[model samples]
Target: MTALPRRGFLTLAGALALGVTGCQLSDPRITGGPTAPPPRPTPTPVPDIPGLEAALRHESDLAALGKQALAAADRLQLGAGQRAALGWMSRDHGVHLTALLAPHPAERPTSPPTPGPRFTPRPEPTSSATLAAAARDGAIRDLTGRLDAALVDYRASARGSRGQMALLWGSLAAYARAAQVALVRDAPRPDPLVVPVRELEPWSDAEAEQQVLRQMHALVYGYQAAIPWFRRPESQTAYDLLVHWRDLRDRVTRLLRDRGQTAPAAEAAYALPVQPTDRNTAAELLWRMEAAFIPFAGAWLAAATEDESRRMAAEALEEAARLCLEWGGPMTTWPGWPG
Candidate 1:
């Protein structure tokens, strides 16, 4: 091969060097093509709302106390009935704990905070009546106080949260209220005239009316089942409940009409979960019926469009829950979100 002139050789060398530099610059890793971007510093998770943490901690503390109370009852060698009652109360606390610990989008730390020290139940009383009454009273007082505080936290959290979280907090507040009634074997007649404001999510008028209609249908069925047992003198409470149910049904019917929707017709009959042979059995059946109404009423309350309608629904819910307590239903942590 003939050697090129110096000028031409220099030009050729420069071109080769430029081409090599271009090739080096095009390496895939240098340009982040087909290579993962530098692992973005893993973002720190946002902390949970202050109210949420407080509620969880409270629930954990209650659960620990419940466990201690149940153990004390067992050690006291209480009667089967008494022990069973205590067990019911303890179970409510367990349920509260489960709800508090359940996975939430806002959850952080992956676990609940450590609960405070376990409560030590008072020693068994000398008198059986004293044990029954005092133990129940003490348990009720403790649960009701804690539950009320939890309600405050939940309500505050609900106000701060959006969408489903708000709904969850409101429902939990209602559950706490129902549990309070259940703890009191003799719940004083809730002020029949005092109506409460129901916390509702934003919904269309049609949606709200539909929910109200559904609740009315539930109350109608409950009334039908309970009215038959009103023959007994002891069924006065049941009679009162029937009248209240009718009032609620009428109110909902009017609400539907106002919204230009038709109220749903009640079924001709509903199958009773248990046959009633006596007044006590009848009360129990009614209690079950009323308990069933709570969630439906709560749904209505949650969806109600007008404040008046929401207030009525809330009152109806409280009435049904109170009646259930009168008839011997166990206190539960989630009355409106029944399994």
Candidate 2:
């Protein structure tokens, strides 16, 4: 077919007729109020994972028991270290179960689909960071009894590999017992600088900023139980690498006090803030810590032979610091803003 000239092929301009237009009567149905009644609830898909649920339940129960023990110790004013240990144990186990169960497909259906970003306020300076604190405390109150019992039993024992291991475990456990008492009487709080603003709730605007400080104190001190293990194996580099972790911990604790002094709350509260500028700093610090841990951990692992598992413990300690620094630090400034 012959093609039309360029001018002749010009497109037609569409026009709306305003003055003269044909109209037809229309019928419309109007609905009132809201929509239909809510539908029946769906059968929750409880994941039948082998032992997962049981473990979660068991840990939860243990944590509850630990909390009770902690409370009892507080009432009796005894075994502070045991109470603290119990508190730590409780919080750790609870956190562990929370993480394990958080990913189950069955769990997803029961909980509402997370529509948008869910913010968690950094923990606040409270009576204790964990139920393990209580357990630790309880253990301490009865330490005299425990130590007396251990000493009585130890005099009759002979030395062996198992004995050495038991001795080490016993010494460490005793140290932990001592620590629980100290922590309970004078619990170290978290730093305020690191506390997120979201943690403060039901507080007036003027007092909310103080919540941030309270949260920092609670969080930094929360890592107290685990952080010191890195230095015990006699490694300066390991300790140096942990400087960031230690600094962050100290910083949070300091911040909490500073902020609290500036803004005191009627009661202790935590608030994780979502400030873009602050988040950026937190993200950068986390990245730095992660980058440092890889090399530090390698150094510890390379020297793992012939020595007591001190090297292994050092490696583990480094890993723990790294993880807390990475996941527990400001998470808002990530791949993208959370919904």
Candidate 3:
């Protein structure tokens, strides 16, 4: 099989379809991406095997919860969107479970089955009376809470995980967290994913972590460029975000240092995937910049076993999804993953 590019990210094509421009990984808009590393080599799979067994059990429990809730969906008085979310989480967990059932990627599912609809923005009922009246509302909320639980354990296990298993844990954690955000309140539900779930060859952990740092650099620059285009309130928001990302850039730089890797110097100007001609494009750039890093950030989460590193990666994953929506990006079932 062909090698995954340093930034193919599986969902790049789908993000472009949403009217956001796809990135050219080679573009060095800022701290130009490190010279292309050779094709991603076959990764050595050595994640925590015992943790894998534990994860498998936890995943089974999650799947059972989703299935039980979904089985009672019609009686739950859930709206179309709510029912869709219930189904989405159920489906996603099952998908994750099925993959885990296979001990190795060689036995992984080849065909991407139906994974239900991702959470979309559904105007939550404004009145408290209606919410309280719903008989099974608590159950639904509990099911969503399990997504959070999944994320927490996934990150914890990642510390002891290695290679492909670690990568799977990171990706599953992201999916659970994003789904919970959607079900709790409607986030922008993205369209069906266009990215194929191909074989599970993952990026080298260190490489994935470094790439996130570089992307953070590019985002800091993008956020700065976007600041001037918004009105006072939005302009301040953008400015604030610029500062946030700048700080995060430095944070990740320090993180890399702690990991025994020296970060590259920042570039003068990073490549702009979609230059902002007006307010809309500027906002578009901001969200896309945030959304772009999520895929590999999962890989970074997998590789980063240290508490600080794992926390950063997990927060980055969740924050990027929320920030994407904050900056006018669509909320999809898969929040961080573009597809």
**What TM-score would every model get versus the actual structure?**
0.59, 0.26, 0.62
Q: Write the per-residue lDDT of candidate 1 for residues 138-230, one digit (tens) a residue.
A: 655765777688778876775555444544565566656665655454433221111222333355555655655554565556555665666
- What does the lDDT come to for candidate 3? 0.60
Worst 10 residues of 2 by lDDT: 330-339
All candidates in order of TM-score, best leading: 3, 1, 2
lDDT of 2 by residue, 126-172 (tens): 34323343344354444334323333332222111121222222222
Q: In model 2, which runs have C-alpha deviations exceeding 4 angstroms?
A: 1-47, 75-318, 321-339
Q: Native-vs-model 2 lDDT?
A: 0.32
Quote the lDDT for 218 in model 1.
54
Model 1, residue 98: what's the lDDT?
Answer: 45
Q: How far is candidate 3 from the true structure (C-alpha RMSD, Å)?
A: 16.1
Every model's Cα RMSD, please?
Answer: 22.8, 24.9, 16.1
- Top TM-score prediction, candidate number: 3
Model 1: residues with Cα > 4 Å off, grouped in runs: 1-50, 74-82, 85-136, 151-163, 186-215, 224-234, 267-271, 330-333
TM-score for predicted model 3 compared with the true structure: 0.62
Q: What is the lDDT of residue 130 in candidate 3?
A: 24
